[model samples]
Target: MDGNQRETIHKIEKLLVERGLRARTIGSTDFPNVSPMKAVEQLMRQCSGAVILGFPQTVIHQGISKPNTQQEKNITDKQLPTPWNQIEASMAFMIGIPLLIIRQQGIEGGIFDIGTTGHYIHTFNLDNYDWIREPSFLQPFNEWYREVLVNNN
Candidate 1:
């Protein structure tokens, strides 16, 4: 996590710990001495659930949608997370692990898009931490945690 999202990440980690779960990340919880793919494979294999945080790592200004196409349209101020988020989320999905997608507000596309995986995408503002305590986050999280509990059995 970068300085921008470090506090948010820590808060989420704390919440997980309070719920008796550990939050693990690639660079933080697991080292990446090996190939990134191999390292992620190893780390995910040991987990029962995955929380894919879609924090904006890239932004596009004054871009085009469907470039060079008949239905092309203008796009602006689009925010996207690292491609790793999609990759890891796909891994967790294929592994049949419970997955929770929490994205910073305004980040969209791929897994962050509604109906992408049919999993609820919980959103929170970068400047506000209140979303963590809201039912919107808690409900899906609780349900996903239930699946995690069931899978462990």
Candidate 2:
């Protein structure tokens, strides 16, 4: 996760704790942007599932040191993601970890359709594990976690 998603994720963690689950926020920031992969590796070894809060695809631009031209539609600059959310998510999936995709408003929700063929693939072979956090985010997770993930293991 990037800096923009940190606050929202913290809120999500609060909700998880409210539902009687132990949660931790791990990312590159914790290691000062040097150890996200190491953290993910350790987490893959330790954690049961992952909660990926997906945001709408958007670009960010900041701290530009250039003059804008009218021909460029008054655009000055744009920011690009460094760690890349999809790569991390893909890693968690390929490692066979249970995933709880919490998509923001207007995004589709379900198991990810991976690769060019776009065949639907369940990360942990669990349906009913992801959804949009509109009415409530805890129900599907609580049910799936208790029944499928926890009881199975």
Candidate 3:
């Protein structure tokens, strides 16, 4: 996670820790002594599941959707998370492990889109912590954590 997301990452880490699970990131928990992809693959092999936090890493103030296409439309304030989240999450999916996707409000498309992975996408506002305490988030999260625990054994 970047500096912009440290606090949110911490809160997520705390939640996982409370449930006897530790959240590990590529740069934070494992340094790349080898190629980055190799390191990430190795980590994926060891994981019971993955929680992909889709925090905005890029924003389009004004742009066009499907530029040059007949379906093109004007877009504004479109936020996108680090592409690494999708990459890592896809790796986890390929490994046949459970996945929990939490996306910031307004961050959509790809795996963040509902029904993309069979797992429910929980959306939250970055400006507040309300989602953490809400049942919608907790139910799916706890359910996914249960799968992780089962996989661990």
Better of 2 and 3 by TM-score: 3
Worst 10 residues of 3 by lDDT: 1-10
Q: For model 2, how does the per-residue alpha-carbon lDDT over 36-152 read when each residue is reduced to its tens digit?
A: 677766655566666665564554444433447544443334323233345556666776666665544333323333442133222221123233243354466665466435633
lDDT tens string, model 1, 1-153? 567598888888998898899988877787878999988887888899999999988888989989899999998898889999999999999888888999998998888999988899898997776778888788888999899888778
> Mind giving the per-residue lDDT tens digits that candidate 3 earns over 1-153?
566467777888999999988887887887878887888889988989898989888999999999999999999999988888888888989998899998888999888999989989888886776668788888888899999989998
Which 10 consecutive residues of model 1 have the lowest summed lDDT? 1-10
Worst 10 residues of 2 by lDDT: 117-126
- Which residue pairs overlap in candidate 3's backbone? none
lDDT score of model 1? 0.88
In the predicted model 1, the residue pairs found to clash are none
Per-model RMSD to reference:
1.4, 9.3, 1.6
Colliding pairs, model 2: 60-79
TM-score of 1: 0.93
Best by lDDT: 1
TM-score (all chains, Cα) for each model: 0.93, 0.50, 0.92
